[model samples]
Target: MMSTRLEPIQIGAPTGRLSDWVIAPMHFNGFAGLPTTRNESVKSPKFSCFGHQWRLLIYPGGDRESSDGCVALGLQNTTKESIEVETKFIIKHPHGGGDIRKGWDKVARLSPKGSAVVGDVGSARGYNNFALRSTLLDYLFDGALIVEVHMRTNKPGQQSAPFVPENPAFQNMLKDFGNEETADVKFEVGGTVESAKGRRKRAKTPTNTFYAHHYALRWNAPTLADMCKPGEVSPTTITNVRPEIFKHLLYYCYGGKIVEGDLQSDAKDIIEAADRFGIVSLKLEAEACYVDTVEVTLDNIVEIVTYADSKNLALLKEHCMDFLSSANKIEAAEKVSFDDIPSHLMKDLMVAFARREGEGSGNGDTLSSMRVSQLRKLAHEKGLSVDGSREMLIDAIKDDEEGGETES
Candidate 1:
């Protein structure tokens, strides 16, 4: 019998043909003996963290956050291994022609695989709608290697502008996303990744080969102690990620192979890094942190937008809005100065209100300050039965006064 192996296809390069047909075949081979490890006897709770373990907070695109708080990871969705895991599609366009409601409804109906409805940016009022989950990005882009989506814009004909690669302001808007690239000035997808000590280096390989073998690869670990050497981890790579996060990322460098009994947080940071870099497998791992453990908090709300670019938390952002509104009603709310909060969260709040209030009429008609104040007065008359309403009304009044316009 003759052997047949297809030639390697390089993605993101201009010359190669985009893969038309790729498939994974199941095998019926007999099983081999399982090998045991020295640390196999010891086990810890899954996702547990302790001394020396590191995890990263990552953005969907796999970049670090600008605030120096969260780590970043880039993910690829096609390689996910779990049969039971849920996936979603997120779309973001800066210029803005797509109707948020219509677009989301279309995705739900049109998706080849029925996906559960996750939250979206347009779900809230003040959101840019251009911001979305990176997991959704892979799906919406649909393996195009490079995608250019049309946006809605105020400018006539500009309503359909492209979300170009050149439009990387969003990527650079955060420190972590911008920090991941090597400064060599050439952007090559899947190029070699070399650590200073020569302990870790990643090479370009085929997706087919990667998935076919069920094999996972990680770069070798290098420490700051070893980084000073001439061939050790590059200074550029070292500079992008935090030392602690990188220290944890070292585990992945060793082939996604963690010590059997290690805590989950140890991998959290690393998984975050992977998500920033578009390493799909890592994002899936990091998402485990929130499963059965999700909560609503203003801090976490800010963190989701600030660190992960995940707008899937529509409810959380709503809570933040309500909290801010309530606080403002009781006493003037501090002007929201952060670009991330005022720009994004406000949008979320508005959309949330509209969704609850009904769009364009009914409850929606009450989105204005006068309506909020009316609701507050009613709540006050009724002993503040509405959660956070009075404070929200107060904030509206304060804003009106500050703007030299009274809310009638």
Candidate 2:
């Protein structure tokens, strides 16, 4: 028989209400095959505990002649430094009453030179005869076993300082800086100028000018910093952007608050300008304002969802999907011209819709309710083929909906 010694499994840091810290659960699979000799031992991968690397060593058979029939377990400090910790080891009961053995706690001083052998440290009792080899098998769940370790510092708790809110005086000081008139850069933006008289185009483009300090622009907009070279002194012309949208972008750069009113009509333009100029915070704020203030209705859901996908705005996409997945709204969602929407977005929307339908609401089964011809039409609209049987077509539709490549 192969030695039942378990391979170490690495796990991520644990999460929960930690008195101090918890270790991710370690699982030992195929427990029945664990080595039954004194020479072999199962060890856990090194995990972070009390700011030091540590591993759990388990001798399924026994670690020595004295530990004949019982399993032996110990904690080893794997680093060069000494660590002091209060630790507990738990072996969950397989049939589900409680731990296989009552857990024991120990205040241990472990070092690179030696391990804190359970039940052996001064007055500290380890689970030496935790279980006999024959009886230990009963604690295995589905031929697997799990162990968890909890650790905390040996130090006394200290009092924490109280929290303080920001000062209003500091806010006033910042507002004064924003209103300063010593601007060093000028931006000339949007108005059509005559290009050629015969073509009925204006020869000179009409534009509005805004002023800002170069330092602020460079600090916030990297693209603007690249375009406005150091020591150069000429007004930079930014064409092809609406004057109002550019105004809002510059306002944000100047620390002016962007109210919902400013974004209601030009949210999309503001987001595009922010993205193009690499103003990440502004882009995020604009996306938030758009989602929070703008209404999602049949008329604009498609446009908004498409824009959200292009910008990778997860919150807006989720909102749009939730709106579209409502039972009363499915018909309106289907009316959307999904042709221009991204394939991935379409797939997500379809999957979400299918799940909602599958929940067995009064809306009859989604697949059975729709005619074969309608299903084919829907597939064809989504750039999928209609050349298969009804079941095959449904499967293909589901495959596409779930982001799988359509089988040829």
Candidate 3:
């Protein structure tokens, strides 16, 4: 049994969006007196997304730059004004298991079996906060970071709140970016807003107004807890293993950040950890490795076949069968092919057939010739008897059938 060596995979530029599922509420603690205020958001001045409620908020640079259960849509403006988004929404992340050949988008939607783990949750009130913070942050910060915005609703009369980029800091932040020219980036993508008097509300409104309660865009990178880690080792030791991979892992821990280059050997161990921890990108890298260089072993072959059988991975099972040709194990091959017997297994099955044939010949006196003929006929129909021997077996079976009829 040859040990399958997993090859190192080369990292490539991401083609699809990242997964950032909302798991918490995005709130501002120091908002004087609001129905939703958080102590954590005030002391350190950082907002969160989707934990108990779904939210989208601004990123205030700080040490504790990590949060659980919130999908991070990092600073991205691939197109003008529109921030690039990444998420692990229950309906989004590609659940390829360990298969690498599967495309990300193709695997994005969850099947019925996988739906429970990916259902939508969290609140829309927090969504309003996320939008406001993101728009305000976009106004204050350089183009360096984009705010996060949410798209799902967890309550009635609540939906994605658009960011208002026309506030005070909005101009100051634009000036810092050398845009000097003042412009308003409208926030309404879809849906309508009504005023307190039941009339239509415009984009600009008083802070005390319900429309002002809308959220801004905000995103964070992956954290230490999000990335792969060595077994029971301190984070410092992990950094020493490979500074770059460790840094990438740190970003993943904060949120998700994929650094390009050859992943270190220690990184491989961490990738394994990432798979266990539900880090999507790390699992993707591991799958790439399995596709690129992992050798198929007997145990792996069995696992692949079994899973393929269960999941209808016909191509994968076929590849496994081809790989097992040289092993020359009859029972194993039979299990994989369901007794169909690959050409490689043909010789083994043939030898067994010859032995059985010889035993039957020696026991000719134990059973009547008619019984043997009938057995040969059944074997011929199953392709178990020799080619062109069908006529002889049929003739014998016909004679036996006739003799039995006469006797009756």
Cα-lDDT of candidate 3: 0.33
lDDT of 3 by residue, 1-408 (tens): 889888554232134433333342223333323222232332222243322222233233211333422222221111112122233212111233321111113212212211233343211112212223322332322222222233321222132456676556544432333111221111112123343334764434222200100011111212323332223222211211223333343334333335444443443444544433344445445434433454677556655545434332223333454566545577555546444433443432333344435544345533232232344445456544211122344455556666779999
Report the error of model 1 at residue 8, Å. 52
- Candidate 2 lDDT at 47 equals 85
Question: Best lDDT goes to which candidate?
Answer: 2
The alpha-carbon lDDT assigned to residue 57 of candidate 2 equals: 73
Model 3 residue 70 CA deviation (Å) reads 76
The residue-by-residue lDDT of candidate 2 on 1-408, one tens digit each, is: 777877454232123312555655767788779887884788888888666787777778877643678887666777777655667777777667657544435445555544454544432224556667777677787888776766665432221236687667535533544233656667778754322122433325467776666666786787876667544567788865677777777767756677878776677778878877867668767776878887888777888887677676655775687677773656775777667667666645665576566643235547533544476688778887554334556787777877754443
Please give, for residues 1-408, the per-residue lDDT of candidate 1 as tens digits.
999999564322222222222121111111111112211111111221111111111232222222222112211222111111111222333235352221221111111122432453111111122233332333232232112221111122212356566655333432232223422111112334445334655544411100100111222222222323332232323333344444334334334344433325444445445545444433444444432244534444455434333422222334455554444432333344345554544554664466455556444434342343355455455443222333354455455555655434
Order the candidate numbers by lDDT, best to worst.
2, 3, 1
| Candidate models: Cα lDDT each | 0.32, 0.65, 0.33
Candidate 2 contains a number of clashing pairs equal to 16
